[model samples]
Target: MKKKITLTGKILLGLLLGFLFGIALKQLPSGYIKDTVLLNGVLKILGSGFTSAIKMMVVPLVFVSLICGTASMGDIKKLGRIGGKTMLFYLGTTAIAVITALFLGSILKPGAGLDMSNMVSGEVTIGESKSLVDIILNIIPSNPIQSLANGEMLQVIFFALLTGIALNLVGKNAEPIKVIFESANELCMKMVNIIMLFAPYGVFGLVSSTFATVGSDAIIVLLKYILIVLLGMIIHVTVVYGGLFKLFTKQSIKPFLNKFTRVAAVTFSTASSNASVPVSLEIMEELGVGKTTRSFTIPMGATINMDGTAIMQGVAVLFIAQIYGVDLGINDMITIILTATLASIGTAGVPGVGMIMLSMVLTSVGLPLEGIGLIMGVERIIDMFRTTVNVMGDNIATLIVSNSENDLNLDLYNSKPLKKVA
Candidate 1:
């Protein structure tokens, strides 16, 4: 009899092969083969297609699953409590992330010995960020259909919640809609499984193309900065998340960690928190979170919970400050923590978003915005790890909220979750 490999095994295999292939391509001399053929041709198609598939599914999944989950809550107050706890947990973890990054950045001194003469002349235009009032106003969509069409995640979420509340208030009149949403949710899951079948190749294309273009030489040059950020991410995930898991459930973290390994690969490969939702929800369900909690929290977490991005920005601010030999006072550090925590909420959970938020943090502390260009070369690679941490944070928030609400199934958490084979 032949043995089947789990999704984690497949993703790891794809990641390894992609890394080797990309590294090999980098060794080749500059030509059409390296530039137009592989980079622009095959890899682009696969990576783009993979991303498109996830995005295409997000609207339907978030809309349907959330509606079903919200209506099932049976009380409007429950929704508010869940939302409150989820956001509070998200904000708390984000603060911890920034603190960890700052501590590590100070200790590692990623920018102390850095040579900036090669690219110090670079300049970047920092866009005017919206005010808090404006961000809040924008959440109420003018047209829910148009918001859904534009992929306005926050607006869609807001509208969905209102609709769900209305359905809950109306009771039996909403049963038909609830029934439809439940069926749609199942359909979305089926689509996710179908999408996973192509995940290996998609990841291979995405990772290989990214490493090939970034090149090993550039990555090696930024090794210090890379290591510092990764170390902070590791500490935040294990210590902060592990602590949260222990405090809320008093259960071992091993099972959740095991299930999340596969989803982390999705976040890393896709470099988008939105793209990781299906897998995150699946993993949470397998690890014992009820559908009501999973549906409401997972989508909301991806939209507003950006702990990993916060860590990158928090550390980047210090790194850029160090590169320019600027000294930061206690006030500057406090400003960075506040700005980064807020920025994570408004920031889009997508690839390259950390850089944009980093600009906000730097500008808040009067650091050089142009300093971003120094690390932009290797940002894509670092983003993969940062995103991995973000996905884990989302699940951790879900677990904590569920466990507290008694929405967790301890039996399922105690038993191993079944794995699907390709």
Candidate 2:
């Protein structure tokens, strides 16, 4: 009898193979084969195409799923409670994540002996920081159609929640609209299923192109910084997230991690939290998270719950400070924690968001923003690991919320083989 490899297995294999292939491609002299054919031609098309396909599903998936989730809750108060819990978990975990990163960065001293003289600094662009009032108002969506078109996730989430609530309140009269949303939700999920079928090839392309393009000299110079950021991510996952899971759900962390392996692979490759939203929801469903909970929590978490980005920002702040010989006091660290936590909510779920959030934190505490230019060398690589952490945080939040509301199906969660997609 022949054994069948699951999608997770195939995706992991693709990731490994892609990394190795990228390393190999790096060895080739700069030429048409390395720069044009393999790097730009095959890898670029497959990876970009795959990522575009995944992104194509995000707006619709988030919109339809949230409506289905909110409307299905059947109680406005319960929806509010779930919303409160989700926000608390996201923001609280993010604060803890930054603190953990700062602690490790301080103790490990990843930047103590860093020599910044020879390193090349890239031009760093920082966006204008929004006030709290502005951010709050922006969530209301002045024009929902524009929000959806522009992919303004927070605004879209706001509109979807309102629509779902109205649909639920209208009772029988809303049944037709509700049914339309349900069908649209199913169709969006089906699109996810189809796109996922090409995940392995996509993973290969994205990983290979990244490694091929990156300069190894920079990676070697920043080895300690790289290791520290990775270490912070690992610790955040094991201690903060894992500890919280055991504390709240009273279940071992193994099952959830096991189920999330596929999502982690995609997130690490794509390096975009929003791009992984549809897949995260699918895996959460397989883990027996109620449609209502996963639908609302997964998309919202992807947009706001940025524990991984917080970790990077925390460590980067310390690294940059040490590089610039700036001594940060307790007050600075506290400000970073608060600023990063808030920035996580405001930041979009896209690639390179960590750097933007880091800039804000640095500005808050009088750290030189030029430090961002120094760390740009290894940012892309670190982004992959941090993205994996980000989506995992999203899934865990979904599971905890679902379990608390009696929306978790233990039998499905513990089943030997995951339920198959139809």
Candidate 3:
């Protein structure tokens, strides 16, 4: 336990020290370090590499875990009902989140006074999709192996669902396949654990590189925009999530929040919910969410949940409107809420996902694609927070939904954390 705490503490401290070191490097004279390289370069490389390593596991982990999850479901009809409820809940919450953001953004109008005309376009590029058909088609992988290799999450999800369903139908014949997949799942988890060991180095690198490139000035320029985005996120997490938790579960929000706050903090710092999954699952189980519920909801939530993404889309659409001096009529706002909410489902669960969804939102509102560059400088910084909220929302939904379905285990949830297995 002591060793585990120390490791976790070191990871956290490294993230903080790395970020501070990065900011300090921004003040140094490049001439002094012309010959001798600085810590920034090292940190940036480590951070990016760390993120890549985490992403490296995303495809396999999601695919295998999802397959195992579906295969474990012996009843197809029950699985269908749970899936339908989950999707509807996810979609409903997402729509609510967007509406909240749209309402808040319109009311606050955070971008009104900002001068973006002089700001140069950011380096981030947005991909263009010609139609909804193309986007839908992209979800069906032509080759399963290629999809996994490419890390196409949606396609991977599609294939995993089918494979799991097939395994379920095969019954006793699928036992060997299930055992093999179970082993693969365990191996993938071990890979995640191994990658987590270097989390500090990766986090440091990512933060250092981000600050070095953007500097603090870009933050200053977009301070209001950032604040508004954050405020919107807070509202969704607190008001939306809190209310739902209380209403559905009839449990004290205090205990839930108390236990999960640490997890949320870690998610906030790490910015990869997939990376945060192990912790989130542990926390939820501690909070008394049953095994079936945790197993079913958490993985699915990780795959499709995007309340945070929805909020970002809402604010992003309004921000673009403000920057371009366009007033989005009520109809336009409604369209944005609908498009952003639906788009969140289709968006991949990876870094820079918000930007892609933002492009889709901007196009929906008739905002210039060029305006996206203005926000690009600060996108990475904000992504970390957005992802944290996304994961939190997923957990909250799982707990609430599980409680409502009478599948929750209140006693075990409030008990001590389980002993870590060797």
Candidate 2, residues 1-422, lDDT tens digits: the string is: 55678888989999999999999998999998788888889999989999999888889899999999999989889999999999999999999999999999899887888788877466677676766577788899888999999989999999999999999998889999999999999999888998999999999999998898888999998898888888888888998888888888898777777778888898999999999898898888888899889888998998999998998889889988888899899999999999999988887788887887888889899987778888887888999989989989998888888889999998888777745554
How far is 189's C-alpha from truth in model 2 (Å)?
A: 0.6
Tens-place lDDT per residue, model 3, 59-176, is: 7777777788789878898678767777887888889989988888999997797776766554656876335667688889999999899877778888988998999999999999
Q: Candidate 2: what lDDT?
A: 0.88
Ranking by TM-score: 2, 1, 3
Evaluate residue 41 in candidate 3 and report its C-alpha lDDT on the 0 to 100 scale.
49
Give the number of colliding residue pairs in candidate 2.
Answer: 0
True lDDT of residue 133, candidate 2: 70
Clashing pairs in 2: none
Off by over 4 Å in 2: 418-422
Q: State in Å the error of residue 334, model 2.
A: 1.3
TM-score of 3: 0.90
The candidate scoring highest on lDDT is 2
Off by over 4 Å in 3: 1-6, 31-36, 122-124, 254-266, 285-291, 417-422
Q: Each model's C-alpha lDDT? A: 0.86, 0.88, 0.76
Mark the 10 consecutive residues where model 1 has the least summed lDDT. Answer: 119-128
Minimum summed lDDT over a 10-residue window in model 3 is located at 32-41
lDDT computed for candidate 3: 0.76
Task: Give the Å shift of residue 82 in candidate 2.
Answer: 0.6
C-alpha RMSD between model 2 and the true structure: 2.0
Residue 197, candidate 1: C-alpha displacement in angstroms: 0.8
